[model samples]
Target: MTPGRPDPARRRWRRIAVVTAVVLALAGANGPWLYRFGSEKYHAYRIDRPEYKARNGRWEIVEFPEGYRQNTIHAALLRTGKVLLVAGSGNDQENFDARRFDTRVWDPVKGTVKKVPTPSDLFCTGHTQLADGNLLIAGGTQRYEKLKGDVTKAGGLMVVHNENPDKPMTIEAGTRFTGRKNGKTFVAQDAVLVPRARKRFDPETGRFLGNDAGLSRVYVEAERRGARHETGAEDNYRVQGLRGADARNTYGIAQKLALDKKDFQGIRDAYEFDPVAERYVKVDPMKEARWYPTLTTLSDGKVLSVSGLDEVGQLVPGKNEVYDPATRSWEYTGKERQFPTYPALFLTQSGKVFYSGSNAGYGPADKGRDPGVWDVRTNEFTKVPGMSDPDRLETSGTVLLPPAQDEKYLVIGGGGVGESRASTRRTRLVDLRAKNPRFTDGPSLGRGTRYPQSSILPDDTVLVSGGSEDYRGRSGSDILEARLYDPDRNSFRRVADPLVGRNYHAGSLLLPDGRVMFFGSDPLFADPANSRPGVFEQRIEVYTPPYLYRGGRPVVEGGPGTLRRGGTAVFRSPDAARLETARLIRPSASTHVTDVDQRSIALGLERTAGGVEVTVPKNRNLVQPGWYMLFLTDRDGVPSTARWVRVP
Candidate 1:
C-alpha cells in the first residue's frame, strides 16, 4: 500500500513487522519449557480420564511421613487387613550393630502407620500364615556378611564332639578352644549344646556297639585379627576350662579357618505375630538357625521350615523341621530334603509340597535344582521335568493359578544364580493334575526379567509387574511395565506403566479393596552407569485395576467370620443376584518375590433371596486353614471389597 518511506502507512507497517519479529524471537528462546509444561498438563488430563482408567487402570504413589518410612525388605498382609512391613536391620550393617530392628504395621485404608518393637533382626527370615490368624515368623540375621577384602577376622565352623555317653553338656559363649597342633586359640561366638553320646546297639542280636560321639556345630573366630592366625588345614582343638574327665570327654575339630568371605548368618529366633494384638509372640525357637528360609504350612496345620543359611553362614544341609501350632514347638522332620534358599514350594491338592525349582540363591547349582513333588512323611521326591531355562530359575516368580483345584502354576521370569547377568523372558506353566506334570513354555515377557512380582486378583486374573532385565537392577535395568494376565485366555494385556522401577527385594499384594499394592525395590545402583549406590525404594505404590473403574462393585455387607470346610456360609449382599463367582484368596506373606501363601480358591456360590451361600472346599490342602479375603465378583467382573473370613 505504501511505496515511499515518508508515507504514514509504510512506517506503520514496518513497525508492526518489527514487533512480530521480536515476539517470535522471545518465544523461540522459551519454547522448550513452554512445550514441556503443555505436554505435562495434557498427560495429566489424559491419564485421569474415566475411559482411560477403565482401559488401562491407574497407579498412585504413597509416600509415608518422614518418620515412618523404612526399607521394607519383607511384607505380609495380616488378617486385620493391615500390612506388616519388616526391615530388621534393613541390609544396613550399622543398624545391625546398633540393634535398630524395625517393623511397622500399615493400614492401607486408614492411611495410618504404627511402629512395632522388633525382638531381633528378622532380616531374610521365613514367614507363613498360621491357622489361628497369626504369622509364624522364624529365623533372622545372626551376623552380616563380610566380603573378602572387608574381613579382618579368621573364622569358620567348629564341630564340637562329646565322648561322654551319660549327660549332655553346654559349651557357653566366650569359651575358648586352643588348637592342639597349631597352638592357636579361637573363641566361640555362641553357645553350643552337645547332646549325650549315643550308645549304639545291633538291631539283629542286640549286641552293644561302640558309642558315637554327639556332634554340634559352632562358629569360632580367632582370638585376634590377622592373616597369621588363619589355619590352613584340619586341626584338633582342646576344650579350654575343662579338666580331667570333662577335658577328655569334649574336644573340637575344625577344617580350615581363613579370612575368606563370610556369608550372612542366621538365628533360631521364632515368633508368632498376633494380628489382633499387633505384636510378636515369642515361640520356641527353631532347633536350627536359618536365614532366607521358606516356611510352608503343611496339610496338618504344621509349618515346615526348610532351606537356609545356618548360624555358621553355610547351607543348612537338608535339616528340615516343622512347627506344630498346638505344642508351639519345632521338631525335626527326621527326613533330609535339601533346597536352595527361598525355594518356591507350594502345598498341592494331594497334601504334598511341590517345589517349583525356583529359588532365591545360595546353593550348589548342580544339587537340589530339580523341581519335584516332595512327600514330607515318606521323604519321596518325584522330579518334574521339561523346564525351560532351568538355570535361570533363581529369583523367578512362581504363582499358583486361581481355583486351587486346578493345581496349575506359572513360573515367571528369572535370572542366573547369584548375581549372574543372564535372565530369561520365558514363563513356564505346569499342571500337576496331569499324569506327567512338566513345565511347558507359556507366554513370554517382552524382555528378560528377574524378580517379577505376580499377584492373584479376585477376578481370576493375575497382575505381573516390575523386575529388572539384569541382576538386582544392575545398570539401571528396572522395568517399569505392568501386565494383566488372563488365565482363561493365557495371554497378557499390557496396562499403564508403573511410575517406579522395581527389581530385587520387591513384591506385590492384592489389597482387600480390589486394588493391588506394591512395595520395596532394592536396586543395586541408582544410575544407568551404576557408579553410585542405589537407595531403597520406600514409597509404596497402589494400583487400581481397570475392573475397579468400570462400575459399582458388589458389596459384601455381612458374612460369617468362620466357615467350616464342606460347610456353607451365608453372606448378606443386596447384589447377590448379580454375583457369579466367589473367591477365597489367602493374604500374601511375600518376600524376595517368593509368595507361597497366596492362593485363590474358588468357592461354590448359591444365590439366595437376600444373600449368597458359599461352600468351602473340603480338602484341607486345597483350602489351607487360615484367614482369607472373601471377595464376590459380579457378572461385570467388578469385585467387592473383601470380607475377612476364616476357614476352619
Candidate 2:
C-alpha cells in the first residue's frame, strides 16, 4: 500500500471484495428461495427475493451518463438491429442558455455519445423516423435574436400582435432579442413550466409528511431585448410529428402559417412530404388558419387537423379542417370539436385519433379555460368522461403520459397544476378501454407533481422520465425520480433518475431492441451554456434493460429464470400492503412472449400467501424446452398481485 492510499492493485482487490459482499448480502435479503427459473419467451431463469421481486414495480436506474446541455429531449430513435441510437434536442430559448441546443446522437454498443447535424438553425418541436429510416424534424424559432419577428412567429403575448389567445404569453420584440447566452432576459419572465409535489414521512414521529415534488422554480419573464422594428416579410411554422398512419404511403403533413401582422392578413398552407422520394410538396392552403391544433389521419384515409388557434378570434370553440391528400385542397369540414385547444392527439390502431389532455382557454382558466378532450368523429364537444380528476385550480387535469398501447393511453406522474385539490403530487394509471375512458388515480407521489412524458415499452411496462414537481412549497421538476408499472402487479415503485434533468420533452421510440431513447430540451433562455434552442445539442441517450447485467430476474430481483415446455416451478406470495390484497401466480414461467411488435406466450398462475404457485399450459406438450420464471403482481382494483413462476 502507498503511504497515504492503497495501490491500484489493492484498490481493485478492495472493489472486488466489496462487490462480493453485496452479492452475498443480497442473496440473504430474505432467505434461500429457489424454484425452477426459466421462461419460454427468452429462455432465462434465476432465484427470487421478496425485496428484489418488489423492485420490479418500477424502473431500476442501473446506470446513467453525464449531464449534458441544459435542455429537455424532444425526439429519440434507437438504431434497431444495431447498437447505436439517435436523439434530437429542443432547447427553450426564452428560459435556457442557447448552447444546450447542441444535438447529441449516442452509440449504445460502444457506450459513446456525440453530436449530429440539424437541417436548420432553428428549434425543433417534433421529430420522428420516416418509413424509409431517415429522421424527420419540424419547428420554428421563438422569433428571438438573429431571427426576426417578420419571418418568425412570436412566442409570447403582445395584445396588439396577439394572434392566438389560448397561449396569451406572447414573444416580446425580436429586434431586442439575442441568443439565450446573454443571461439578461430572466429578469422579467413570468411564463412558467408547471410544478410537482412529493410525499414524505416525519423521521422522528413516523408520520406521513407531504411536500412539493419538484426542483427549483425558474419563472420566465418577457422583456424587450432589442429596439422595436418591423419589416414586411413572411413567417413559416412547422407542425407536429408524422401523421400518415399507413407505412406504405410513408407520407406526412405539416402546416406552414405565414402571418404578416403589418398587413393583418394571415396565410395558412400545408406541406406534404414523401419519405420514399425524399422530397416535400406543398398542398393547398386552408380557407381558415389554425394554430395549436392536432392533425389526425382517419381510417378512411382522411386527414383532420382539429381545434387550433382559430382566426375567428374565439378561444374555447374550435372548427375541424379536413385535408384530402389526393384532392390537395383543405376542405372546411364540420364543427367536430368545439373545445379543441392544444389537445394531445394519438392515433389508434383503428385509424381513429385517441384525443386527451388539452388547455381550455388561450390562457389559464382564470384568464379563460382549463383542459379537456374533443372527439372529431362523433362531432363531440361534451365534457370528457373519466378525466374529471380533482386539481388544485379546479381545472380538468389529466397526466398525459405516453401511450400504453395503440389501444390504451398511459398516464404516469402529475401534479395539481390545473387541479383545485390539496393533494397536488400524484401518479396515475389511465386504462383507455372504457366507453367513457378517463383515469384512475394511482399511488400518490406522496406529494403533488406531474410527469408529463413517459416511455412505454412493448411489454406494457411504463418508464416515467421527467416532469415538474412541487418542492418545499415552491416549484420543481420531476427529473430526479422514475417509476415503473406492471399491469400484472398493478403497482408502482420508485426507480433511479436519469443522470441529468429533463422535463416537458418528447420520448421517441426505437424499434427491434425495444430500448428507450431520450432526446433533450431547454426551459431557460440566455446563456447558451446548456442549449441552443435554434442551434445545436451536445448529447443523446438510450435506456436498455439491465437484464444481462442484472444477472437474474427480468427486473424481478431476488431471482428469475426461463421455463421449459415440461418443467414445473413454485413461488411464494408476498404479504398485503395497507389493505391491498394480492393476486396469485401459477405456472410461473412464460414460454413464448411476443417480439418487438408482437405478444408473449401466456402461462397460467396459482395463489399462495408467501408468494405464488406456477404451472404450464397443457399445450406446452408441443412447445420446446427452456428455462423460465413466473411473475406475480397486484392491481389495486381487485387488490390482487400478479405472480410469475419459473420453469427451469
Candidate 3:
C-alpha cells in the first residue's frame, strides 16, 4: 500500500476494523437496556433466582363501595371482620348535627356501613382492645363551637352596664348574644351582652347565673333605673325566664356567658364497643375527663390510661390510672406517670410499658417524648438514648417489629410539635433485648412524612403508607407512595402508591386476608367546605401487597378456634412440607398513628404427618389474651388467608 492510500486488500481490512470499533461502541451504549430486558423476560422466569423473587411484591388499591356520611377520623379492625369508623362531628359541626351519624360499622364483606349512635363527641379520642375482645374507647370532645354567623338567629336580652353614661346603651349591629325561651335556646344575631353599673349591685357577688330567672332580674333592674327610657328602646328586654340549665358553675361574666351558651369541652366518657351486639355499653368513666388520652392494655388484661386534656380542656397532670374489667372501674394507679397525649406504648413481655418515643400532638415536649421503658409496678422510667429527632415525632407511625420473639420496636416519620409544620424522614429501631437498649438508626424514608401508618405483615415485613409532609397535609405535602421495610435486610423498597392522599386523622389496619385497609383522612381538620374533594377521604382503600399475587398460597385447612396461652395446637395445611413459618397477629385498634394493642407473635412450627403442630407462647406479654389472626406462610413467603383464633 502507498503511504497515504491503501491497496484493495489493505483498504478492505481497514474498513472492517472501523466497522468493528463502531459496533463495539454501540453495544456499550445500549448494554444496560439489553441486560434489563433479558433479566426481566428470561431471568425473572427462573424461580430459583433470589434477586428476581425479591422484586415480586407489589401494591393493589381497591375503592370502597360506599362513602361515609361524616369524615372518618378514627378507624379500627373489629373482631367480627368488620371495620369500626368513628368521626364525631367529623370537623363539620353543622353538617354533623344535620346528619347525626358520627359512628359507623363497615362490613367489608357485605359492602355496607351501618350507623351507630355515639353518646359523646369522639372527634379526638384514644382507643385499645381489651382482653375480653371489646374495644375500650376513651375521651372525646363534649361540644364544638360555631361562629355566631354560622348559627341560627335567636338573641337574648342583656342589661347594658355602660360605664360611660354619656354613650347610649347602643348595641352594635352584628353583635352576638345567646338567649333562652320556652326550654329552647336561641342566639341574638344583632346585639351583644352589655350590663349597666348599679350602685347596690356588687357584680362579683351577683353570681350571675345563665338561667332566665337570673337574667330577668337584671333586665327588671335596668328598667327600674330608666335604662330603657335613656336608650329610647323600641324593643323591650324580652328576657323569658332562663329555661336551660348551665353546664358549668361559675360567677365571672365570661364564665356565665359560657354557661349560657354551649361550648366545647373535653369529656370523661369511657365506653366499651361490642362488635357483636353492634352497640356501645357504658363503662365507668375516667376519674378525670380526658380529650386525647391513650389507653394501653396491660399483659394482665387491665388497661392503663395516660395523658389527655381534662374536662376543662387543660392537660391532665401526669397522674395515670388503670381500668379493671373485673370491677368495671378505673383505679388511680397511685403513680403520676406523665406522658404526652396518645403516647404509643407497648406492653413488654415482663409487663412493663415501653414508650416508643412517638406521641400524638399535645403535651409538654420533654415530659413523655423521651423514648423509655416505664415500669408500672415501680413507677420508674428507664430512658432509651440515641434517638435522632425525638422531639418532633408527633403523629409518627410506630410498630413492634414482627416475630414477637424479637423485642424490637421501630418508630417511623412524624411532624414537629405545635404547628411547627416540619416533617421528619428519620427512622429508628431499639432492641429491648439488648443490654443497653438504645435506639439506633434504621433506614430513612425518601421524604419526610407525618401520620404514616405502619402495618406489620405476616411475612415479618412492615408496610408504611399514608402521611403528609406538612402538619395538616397542605397541598403537595401528601405522601402517596408506600414502602415495605424488610427486617432481614433492613432496607425499604418502594411499592404501589394509593391514589388518595392521607394526612392528619388518617388510619390503617391489616385485615385477615393479609391486605391492609387505609381509611379516614381529615386533612382540613374536618372542615368539609374548605377541604378539597377526596381530601377528607371518606372512601376506603384496600392495599394488597405483591406477595398475594404469587400463586400457590399455603392453605391452613383446620386449626383450633380457641387456643390457650402456652398451649399446643395442631393445624392442618395441604402444603405442610413447604410451610416455612406461622404467625399470630392481634387485631389492631389503630388511630392517629397510635396502635395500642396490635402485636405479632411467631409460632413454633413442626411438620406433622399431614400438617403442623404449632406451639403458642405461654408468655402473656408476647401473646396477650384476645382474638388473633393465625397465618401460615410457605417457603416462597406466600401466606394463606388468616383464620381468626381466640386466645383465652
TM, every model: 0.96, 0.46, 0.74
Query: Which candidate leads the pack in lDDT?
Result: 1
Sorted by TM-score (best first), the order is 1, 3, 2
- What's the CA RMSD of model 2 in angstroms? 20.6
Worst 10 residues of 1 by lDDT: 1-10
Cα lDDT over the full model 1:
0.93
TM-score of 3: 0.74
* Model 3 error, position 446 (Å): 1.3
Error of 3 at 371 (Å): 1.5
Model 1 over residues 1-648: C-alpha lDDT tens digits?
456447787779999999999989988998998899999999999999999999999999999999999889899999899999999989888999999999999999999999999999998999999989999999999999999999898999999999899988799999999999999999999998999899999999999998899999899999999999999999999999999988999999999999999999999999999999999999999999999999999999999999999999999999999999999999999999889999999999899999998899999998998999999999999999999999999999999998778999999999998989999999999999998888899898989999999999989999999999999999989999999988788899999889999888889999999899999999888899999999999999999999999999987887779989999988998888899999999999999999999999999999998999999989989988989999999998899999998887
| Per-residue alpha-carbon lDDT of candidate 2 for residues 529-639, written as tens digits (9 for 90 to 100) | 423322322344555433212332221223234444434444443432212221111111000000011112334454444444444443321121221112333332222
Candidate 3: tens digits of C-alpha lDDT, residues 544-567: 777776777888887779988777
Regions of model 3 farther than 4 Å from truth? 1-68, 95-99, 145-264, 525-535
Candidates ranked by lDDT: 1, 3, 2
